[model samples]
Structure formats: C-alpha cells, structure tokens
Target: MTKVAVISANGRVGSLVVKELVERGYDVTGFGRKAQNTTVAQTYIQKDLFELTKADLAEFEVVVDAFGTFAPETLHLHVEVIKHLTALLAGTKTRLLIVGGAGSLYDDPEHKTQLVDTPDFPAEFYALAKAQTDALTELRKHDDVDWTFISPAADFQVDGKRTGKYILAGEELTLNDRGESIISYADYALAMADEIQNGDHIKERISVVGK
Candidate 1:
C-alpha cells in the first residue's frame, strides 16, 4: 500500500482529504495537534505543525500540507511550515501537496492582479490570504521535491455537498454559470486526491471550482 501522511489532518479541509485518501485504499496517516475523530487513518501522530521533521515524514510517498490558520497575527505559520517541509523533503521522492487558498489565484489571464488585490476582498481574512499567497511564492522557489498546490475557488462552501464534480483550471479563477466562484471542500478533496494519484500538475498550482 502507498503510504500517505496528511499534516493538519484535523482541519476542515484536511479531514476530508484524509477520508478521500483512505477511501482510495492508500495507507493514510493522520498528523495533527490532537487525535482526529475518524477511523480512516491507520496511524495518528500528534505533534506541533511547526516542530515536524523530515524523519517524521520520511515514510510517506506524499505529504499533504493542509494546515490552515485564521489568526491574523500568526498567519505566517502558513508559509513557515511550507518552508520547513520543502527544506526537509528536498531531494526525496516524497511529493509535497499544499492546500492553497484562492488569494493567490489570478484575477485575469494576464496574471497582473490576484484575487486578494481586489477592493471588495474581505478584510477579516486579508492577513490569512496574504500569508497563503506568500507561501505559494515559497513553493515556486523549490524544485527539489515534487510539489503541487491546489487552490479552491473564491467562495469555498463549508456546508456544500459532495457532488464529486468540479472544474479544474490553472492560475485563473473558475466560475459557474451564474458567474460565481465556488467549490465545496468535499469536491476539493476529491480533486486533490485525484491529483496525488495522477501526478499531472507537478510543481504547479491548480484551481478547482463548482460546475
């Protein structure tokens, strides 16, 4: 069985990724600050997200960095963990899969402005958004370990249903017929797991939107 470790496996998106991977028959391992409520993982490792070492991740074929933070002051944790993990996993076969935000997604095909650059962007999540975008910059600098960044649509619905269908795109934000950008976490997890198994978007950022 392929071993996969999901960092931040207890978070909203992380937990769904865990379930997705588990259902696919991968030997999934959950790593979090505390035990998760699911039985899908074969093992659960409780450790601070910042304190993790490569040795802790050496066993997995893929490492999903699903760690997320809402606190504005400590939003840097988003980039810090990416920096540390890429440094450790460099030159190894382990692929780094980052759970990215929509902030980094470009607003136009010219790629001049990002979604976060818009005036109507929510201020409450601005700090977190900036941190995630910076983290993408950090991922772009590394070529050692294989990496894939997956960004959700602007309206990420926490309570949305798992339609098991989503539109995949490059840097540009995708939208539905109503011209709204959205995707459910369940479908996002589905696409993410499919990416890990397919290896089609290595070292690139991909986006998912509702159909």
Candidate 2:
C-alpha cells in the first residue's frame, strides 16, 4: 500500500491519474478545489493549492503536482509552486512527480531547441507553455529533492479513452507511426502510474505518446 497524493485531482489529467493509481491499488488521496470524484480517492481534501503546507503532505510517499492553468497572468505560479514544493520536501523521502506540458520537449534529436522556440509554435499557448518549460528548469536546479518531470505529447487528447498502450521517450518528443505527437489523457495516466511504480526515471524528464 504505497501512499500517494495527487494535487489538482479534479482536472482532466489529474483525475485520470488518480483513477489509474487507485485501480493499481495504491493508497491514494486527492486534493483539489472540488471533491467531485470521491470514488477515485481513498480520501479527498478540498483546499486551495497554495494553502497546502508540507506538513499536510507528509503522509504520502509520492506527491504528483498536476496543477495547471491556461491563463497568462497566473503562469508564473507554475514555477512558484515547484520552488515551494522543492523547498518543503528538500530533505524528505517524499518524491515529487510533476505533470509537465509538452512545450519544453525537443524539436530534434540534437536537443538544440525546445518546441516552444520553433517559429510556427502557436502564440496563444506561448505563455503557458513557457511557464511549464520554466518549471522544469527550476526542478533541474535542485539537487536535494528527488523529482521526475513527465511531459505529455504535443497534441494531448482530452476526450481520448484508455487503451492502456503508450510509448515512452526521453527528453525528445515521441511520435507514432503516422508521425503524430499525441496521447489520450487516459493512456497518459497509464504511463504515469507505471513510472510511479517503477521509479525508473527518477530525477529525469520523460514524455509519452500513443503507440
């Protein structure tokens, strides 16, 4: 019964991750603004993300930060929360797993530039994408905490179902046979749960896409 806590558990990706963990028989808890999906969690906490302290999370062996926002004004908080969590869990055994965006993924094998740096990248998602990229940067600076950042495919499917099949890749973006970088939220959760159980990518960044 490994203990796990999922923040932002009400969101699309977060909820699916909670479901995956729960079905895997992990002792799971969910924290969010709303407590709609109580069945997926052994226990649910309704609290603001920032209001949660390290003490509140001390019970879990792993904490998954699934927090996300599309608004430009609050994008900086993405990195802020990372800094806060790193500082709080600096000397503890609790591991941090971040659900990162695909913007930071490399456009090529050389790893010269991220997808966000490409010329054709959409302007509307620039701020949010860069913020997620910066969050990964912040995680890299810390040597005291054990953390793993998992990025989704460039084209993440919100309504996609769980096929329980996905391809995992390193820092570079992953593509399918048709050359599409996409993954369903349900399948993404499968990859995430696998990482939690295996701990194979500790202190590293990885990505997943549909096979």
Report per-prediction Cα RMSD to one decimal: 1.2, 1.2
Clashing pairs in 1: none
How many backbone collisions does model 2 have?
0
Predicted candidate 1 versus true structure: per-residue lDDT over 1-211, tens digit per residue: 8899998888889889999998889999888887554546778888887788878988889999998888777888888888899988999999999999999999888999998988988988788899999999999999897999999998898989999989998998788888989999999999999998998998999999988
1-211 per-residue lDDT for model 2 (tens digits): 9999999998888888899999889999999987475547888999877888879889889999999988778899999989988987888889999999999999998999999999999998889899999999999998888899999999999998888888999899778998999999889989999999999988999999998
* Local lDDT at 209 for model 1: 90
**Segments in model 2 whose C-alpha atoms lie over 4 Å from true places:** 35-39
- The alpha-carbon lDDT assigned to residue 125 of candidate 1 equals 75
Please list all clashing residue pairs in model 2, or write none if there are none: none
